[model samples]
Target: MGKKKFHKIFISMLSFILIFSFLQPSQASANEGLKINADAAILVEAETGKVLYAKNPDKVLGVASMTKMMTEYLVLEAIKEKKIKWDQTYEVSEYVYKVSQDRNLSNVPLKIGEKYTVRELFEAMTIYSANGATIALAEKVAGSEVEFVKLMNKKAKELGLKGYKFVNSSGLNNKDLKGMHPSNSGPEDENVMSARSTAKLAYELIQTFPELLEITSTPKKIFREGTDDQIKMDNWNWMLPSLVFAYEGMDGLKTGTTDFAGFCFTGTAKKKGMRLISVVMNATDENGKGTYNSRFIETKKLLDFGFNQFELKEIFPKNYEVKGHKTVSVVKGKEKEVKVHSKEPFKMVVKSTDHEKYSPKFQPNTELLNDKKQIVAPIKKGETVGYLAVQAKERESLGYLTKEEANKARVEVVTTQSVEKANWFILALRGIGGFFGDVWSSIVSTVKSWF
Candidate 1:
């Protein structure tokens, strides 16, 4: 009997220790050499929309054809709402023809008055990033480029992209530099957004229409399919395994570059059921060469960092046990205290650097539980008196804790067990016990302070 009692006490102490251990601060040294050279960059998880890593994430810059992703987003949203049909044939406008005729710019020139379905135009815009096709879809959707841009800005605002702005449905800029191909031309229109804001836009894209990957992930395609009018092209995201910088699992999103934007890419990849989104904007050569490789290499580095430095951890396993028993006061319980647990398991993505101080955090809702000091009676079996929340935290080498949202991640928790109401005699006994307990605890605290 003595051994059994000791074992129970040991278990209780261990549970208590484990629960509070999470409150102990933990930290790791951040490597200064890990920084990437980009005007701005951000890495995020597609599902949770968590910012995994960032560098100058809020620095606003022009996003060349990456603007096409938003254009495609609006285009797809239109199709989903049935405002336009994918297979429905549409006319090529004079504006589209003029933009298509730019010999220096990539295009799938639509013969004036020659009609094509929405699907054809969308394919050209997404795969080839044909500026003319982009403008055509914009005009088809909103009646004109000017109007489509309004819809783009409105959509950007709705996505919580507060600092983003769109000047045109097609991302052509308004610079008149003679040496550059597709130099910004007329009315000073260019799609501009910060790297962080850009990631938010990309996150919403996959979250809303995940199947859009079917098209974006395509490495190469024939624009007109079997007709002699077909135009074959490769995807701009050269990260695909079939092309250069083949980081395994890289599917699709978009890439943009111009004399002004430099080079930018929003890439997403999936490995073992986990998907990550990475964005790099305005990556330029250290020597001022301004090659496209800088953005691709830096993006690969970012994804590698995300996949290597962090991993998903199930903080609370299925039927996980959290020992929470209060024997202090039950206003009217048959017995003195009650035990509680969670009905479901909780899980969250944990960074490898933050794993040492993991713990289960309890966020009991006293408002609904009706008891902060002591339990009020009339408790029913299977009632939720409180919640068990598990949070992910990591200390920074700066000798400081990161703000709650930035450093801590939380998981879902619910209740399992319930307490029953006690009789009047039991309630009286509990009241007396609680009063003495409080007195004893205060006296103990006072005595400890003297030591």
Candidate 2:
């Protein structure tokens, strides 16, 4: 080959290699330099529902026993609404008895014709992930497991969880129930949820019922402390303090594993007043086996990234005004324009390096504006005239969890002082003066045009 031709071919191949390298799938995206080993994962700030990081977050996957978080939410809601009491006793059903007796599944054996308090069953389900206990609570709350499954789906919809399904109260595969799965659900069905939805569910659950932490944080408890059937119940979530796979600041959460679901976890931790919620679905080891600790390991990567990389920073102070939008025009008021500022402080979880990337995006409220887009006089101080939201300068911002949250994310901008209407005499004088001014201006323009 000619030297020049060879040089050109080599340069083109080098360029192609560089482009291909750039297109390769990265372990993470923009500022999140951590690699997570899971089919789907997400980490979010608990207070704001702002997603800090995500990996295939919307991919639908079997959530295994992480489905129990929904069950826990319903049970807590029932107690709060006075529909059921923690002390209420429930009779063991034929379905619950059979499932509880299976040693292969997680359960605290329940004998038929015996009564157990709601608190007992809840403890078992929450702490040990006892499938039968979860079902018993479901039956007690909704009259039948079938109806309870309906309630679960209803509440999931109400909560705005998208593309989620609950086949049974327990996160077990339908076949695990030995033909006692809820009616209308396939025998092979398993509960499924996206990592984003799963994290949102956990966020809402904790925000609504903060007291559930007292139970889930327990490392171990006695299922029937003094009875002959007493069994030592150990929490499936090993990330709690003092647990085998404990992580600092980790607390109440749920874990799951099944043949189809692999291992999944919905974990939360609080440190220095910042709480983070994370979900890892189908986590596996190097061998692709969903070992017991694989979920925790993947979860730690997320929590660590959140805690170490992000901080709750005040993006804008309360009453701060955006540049180029610091004031709004007012008609027939004491002032031609009025100063406007944010009604509340804008705070969000963001990386330290990201402060420079954010800029204010101000939107005016058209309802309060005239055809000229000027505010009418008699405006009240602190009135909402506009909204201010932040935009990332470079990179796709991880938005809020829900539409409602996205709407609420902005800060209201209000007038700094009220503007009063001008008096009729002054308005008439200005109107008459303005007429002569217009005539003179027209005459001057005509004179200038002629010259």
Candidate 3:
């Protein structure tokens, strides 16, 4: 064969191999082999807000009681902002009175003239998914549910939530125009939200009110304890331990069901010090296993996938102590080097089985003092010299992330002790020693040449 023809044939074969290699599946994050029977679904890590898994995540649909999550967010904001108090009592309006006792809805047994503390109502709303309780809390925050829903829509905008709209504080669709929001144009007005928006709201909700897990993580709670009106309420999320669909590390969020929004769940779980939020919308009533409530089943799938697929690699343990190679050198100071301590733990999330494929780079020694050329003396004790940042790189097929987008954690690097400037006498001695060291080297080189 001619030399040119031989080269052409070789290049063709090499190109095919390269293309075929690229087509091979990446084991870092697998999307197949797990079937999620939901219209829209998403899974995200709380710390990084990194989306791990998604399926038609942005499609908009009615979210039913999941609207209560936003209602809970606003109510908590009101309490923290001192707009209301936990001990304060709210008069049970006729709206709440009727709605709470509605046989068609999930509600608390409420008396028309009876008053309840803010804490009681809040718990009833979150723990039991009480429509009237959430509406009551909404009314407490705003003048009425109509006004409260405006706040919800405003907050949604602030969160950059698109393809979603809130028509009511509770997720109920109103059949009467009197019960409709100002934005409602027709009788049927159900709150609409995409799974992505719902997940984003869940993420922000947890970040803002971390204490919410205390209320939501409970398997069961009793309102009006030790009273005639006492009603023991159980959580709708069966993911809690000892439940029919119990799962370890499963805590909360909310569940929803309606003719339009069939069996939806926005759930959170914490395992191995890592927290993840998963949202499954419009899940079928059956998993084809004769097991009803497919929302919880699919949620378990997502959460299990998240926990099993990712591992938290702790670069520095929480409340870390300075020891070993975790130290940075100090120049021209009283001490030649000082131990570096992390102000907070640094961790990176990576594929559980692909830890070896990542290369984490932490900089404090290198990037100290705004990438300082030299850290001079007179550094104060507990002074922030630099920051420790950790990044992990691995391969994944996520289009949102680059080929090596790694999880990052950062914390300040502080000086353990003051580093005073070296005295003039010490500087002079070092200069003399350095001068003699150079002279000795020159003499030694000359003597060896003579030999």
Candidate 4:
């Protein structure tokens, strides 16, 4: 064969192999073989918000009682900000009392003209999915459920949640609110969000207040214990370690169910120093009917896929420097260039087989650079010069719950040593040397062209 033709054929074959490698399925995508059996589902790493698996992730659907997770988050914020106290009591409103009396809804009966403390009501709402308790806490925080729904929407925006709308504090259909739905929504409107948004909410809640696990992990509790108003409250999260569908590392979260919302769950579990959050919306049985257990079954499949197929792998160690990107040019400094390295190790939860697929995407701090893309003198040791972001070398990415999280999936690049300004004499000498070098290079190039 001719040399030119042989080289062309070899290059063509190489191009095909490179393209084929990227087209192959990633370990997380391989979960496609594992059916989730839900309308919308997502699994993410709690620490990094890395999405390990998804099914119809962006499809908006009724959240049912899972709306209480927002209520829970707001109440916790209220307590933290001193807007409300846990021991503070609220008198039962007629609306709350009427809602509590309904047997069709999950609730702890609240007598007319009676009062309940914030802690008592919060427990009832979170553990038992009590709609009345949820409303009661909502009122305590915002003075009324109507106003609380506004706060829910406001906070959802603040948290960067997308594809979400809160019609009521509880996830109950607005029709079940007895004509007392939030003024901004229709009477039949039920709180709804996409699986991805739901997971993001859960991620924010856990990261902000990890102590919530203490209450959510509770299997059973007595509301108003040893009182005439006392009621036995059992947590609806069957996947808790103490519950029937107990899975190792399973902990606190929320569950929701309504005729309109069907069955939904937001669950989290920590095992082997890694935590995962999973959201399953409108889970159904083989017959295509929503069942109480179907949510847990679907959640189990997601969590199992995460724990079994993925693991925390440190792709880059602390202080590691990227090839061809280890140094930043300095202007008027003792050193012409300063070495930079990552502030922390880059760790991610990914399948072992996929570790090689990710590479460092270095982003220099443009603000710190001048016209020549060089830093001004006197750079301090450990000073941030840029960021080292992780990017999939190919098109296949496990993804993240939020774009913000994706942007933040990076480590700081800092200077290795302080750089002092060069002495005036040295600077002058360097300038003279550079002028001579440039003149010499120009004359040499002109002579070579003539030759």
Candidate 5:
């Protein structure tokens, strides 16, 4: 080939390769223009469990009072298990009352020996962010704050939260004032959690105790012992507008702030069967007013992107038949043929442009029974024998097994007989004699009737 032609061909091939590579999807380009705090952030679809966005989500950070989400989760579990009654009165212990007495502490101000019901304590802890109320409720439910912290850690591990540690029911920093430790081993600087774990914990709490919103979403509540005496408290979340907006589905969740943790919030909103959880941590005050507009605005942007950009589509309805499996052999069965069907629906979300690209694939067990076309004796209906998976182009959405339909298999039996040659003539003679005897008896009976 000429040198000029060779050079042109090589350049064209290289151009094609570069174009194809650029056309392929990359994570960085897919997430462009979404802004977040430098510390950590995550956005997730609660129903589909799809991670819509994440930024340093796994990085560990002090979560401050967001720890109360887990505390509230355990409390709901206790209620569901009937371990404590909603109206059960608990006497305020001296320890809890002393903690409440801290002027700096956000508390419900339970006096020593005074009693309050579990419901009142939960409202104060979850709505008012009352530290003393949380500790009291933890001790009342788990016998001690130490035991409750253990429960929180166990639940965290169970939920696969790897970057979390709990030293107390309330997420109070225990930094030493003198900046000196006896051995640097006592509590190991007990910081609470990360944005990913905090969002997950909030989601679980809402699912477990949806009734919490009935208290948290209220703009104000007045707790009073008598007609004239009352203490009124207002909600900390400012996103909930007094007048409903397009995002009226917004509901109750927790907010946190500390000098180290700097204005964090976990917010949940739902619309049209879809729910989303958004978290932001370590947001700097954008206006230099020590306000949390950074957290609020960034969270609003992420939530708006999620709610506006995507939707859930049922690619496959539950129990919808995909295709039949090849016949399998059954041992000790009559007729041979068994069909496989799906046990549940398959579904996924796709861009409105990509919905037509979805398809399903069936995978079945090829091992045949003795009969080679049917299942073995006593094969029950609705038993899963294979799986069906739905996909969007190359991405798989959901996979589940196909089951047998009702009364699809039956038993078949066979029998055979043979006569020896020597008995053949005797059998023929006896057959002719019996035929003549039957004719003679019929004639005699007819004659007797006539007489």
Candidate 6:
């Protein structure tokens, strides 16, 4: 074979290999321990908002003090908007004092005459699940618990948390009234929320108020202002300071337990460059006891499965070209060939184990024009004439258009240079001569038919 023919064959082979390499599919690694005994659970990546695992995640089950996440979200928004100052003193309201006095419920032990900073109350409520502190801060910020609940619902809607309801800042169950009061009022209402909604709310809280971690992660905090005796609240999260593999980047979210709601917890943990939010609700002890340790165990299992199974890999760099379109023909253009280029890069998430096997596909749309196939005189640059598309394993991903060149100027028919060259006039005169010749041929053919 001639040298030029061998070179052409080698180039064709290389092009085929490149095209095959860009048309492979990516796969995810298999995950273990996906089964957990909570009524509903979800594990999601905080940065990309990708769900790693979910089991009945959207089921609307009661989520106890996890409701405090909404309360915390509003508080942070208030602080960010300058509506509430962290160090400002707030007088303990009558309702807050009454709730604090109740030994059956969680309390920061606020006194009737004493004052506490908004930051301290927030710490108690978020770290210790202090019901009284939650209500006190709500009233201080919104002037009433009812208004705070309204704000919570409004924010929930704004966050696109569907199927969520908040009757109070605290997730306490409302009293059921079988009979009407003397004033003939209607039956009492109740507060409720779902595990999925709880997780979304907590995720938003951590994203908005990262400073809340300083309080939530603290295993112990002591309040020394209200009563003769100091009140110390230990963080209820058992996984924070107890477990051997307990993640370091873990922080305060909330835990909830009631006879009706069972054990519930929304946990947020971050490590390296990844953050995960897990929610477990309706977990019960082997003996049917409502406790949070069960929820914690399930959450840990989900997080472990996520960290062990998959890893994020960037397949392509930003603005990297994947492929280019074939040369296209344009009529009356100075440029003979126009090549199309991609405007953006192509990428895909693949399993670490499957990195060698996965491949990407690039497809560019090229169409043949009906005009001149050779260099002409009228094409302009950067004018869009056609488009190109990219695909992965036959699946179309993105598409963009090809532009014309700007440097190629149009050729005028009647210029002084063209007249001087004589070649332009010769070609124009030949075109006119050919037109007259065709007309004369047609007349002769008609006369021959009559003969």
Runs of candidate 2 with Cα error greater than 4 angstroms are: 1-28, 31-33, 332-337, 370-372, 393-396, 417-451
- Specify the poorest-scoring 10-residue window by lDDT in model 6: 400-409
- lDDT scores of the candidates, listed in order: 0.71, 0.86, 0.75, 0.85, 0.63, 0.61
Alpha-carbon lDDT of model 6: 0.61
User: What's the candidate order when arranged by decreasing TM-score?
Assistant: 4, 2, 1, 5, 3, 6
Residue lDDT tens for model 1, 1-451: 5754565566557645544443232312222346666888877767655556767776889898889888889989999999999998888877677778775776787879889889988888887778888888988998887778788888988776746778777677743212222222245556788987788788889889998899988888988878877888788888987888788899888888887888888999988567889898887666645577888888888888878876655667654555553222455656545555555565445566665556676654444443343566555555555455554355332111112222234332333445667667777877899999999999999999999
Clashing pairs in 1: 173-184, 174-184, 174-185, 175-184, 332-421, 332-422, 333-421, 333-422, 334-422
Model 3 alpha-carbon miss at residue 284, Å = 2.1
Top candidate by TM-score: 4
Q: How many clashing residue pairs appear in each of the predictions shown?
A: 9, 0, 0, 0, 9, 7
Q: Indicate whether candidate 1 or candidate 4 has the larger TM-score.
A: 4
Q: For candidate 5, what is the lDDT?
A: 0.63
Per-residue lDDT of 230-342 in model 5, one digit per residue for the tens?
45656566666552222456776777777767778788877766778888887655554334566677778778877777666666665555554433333333423444555
Deviation (Å) of 281 in candidate 1: 0.8
Predicted structure 5, TM vs. truth: 0.72
Candidate 5 wrong stretches, greater than 4 Å: 1-26, 175-188, 225-229, 243-246, 285-290, 324-335, 363-377, 394-451
Worst 10 residues of 3 by lDDT: 398-407
Candidate with the larger lDDT of 1 and 4: 4
Query: For candidate 4, lDDT tens digit of each residue in 1-451?
Result: 9755565566557545533442232545556678888898888899887888878888999998889899999999999999999899999998899899997889999987887889989989988999988898988899888899999999999999889999899898898888777788898677889998999999999999999999999999988989888888888888888778999999879998887878889999998778999988889977888898999998898888888888888889999998888998999999999999999998887785888999887766655755355789988999888878666887764466776776567789999999999999999999999999999999999999998
Q: For residues 1-451, what per-residue lDDT tens digits would candidate 6 score against the true structure?
A: 9755565566557545543433211112122436777787776555434456666666787776788888888988999999999998889877777777766777777888888889888888887788878888888888877677778878888886767767777776544211211121223444566655676677667767788777778877776646574788878787785444366567756888766577888777776556777888887555655565777777788777766664544444433333432344433333335543333332222334644454433322212222222223344443333322222443321110000100010111111111112246655776698899999999999999999
Candidate 6 global TM-score: 0.66
For candidate 2, the per-residue lDDT at 56 reads 86
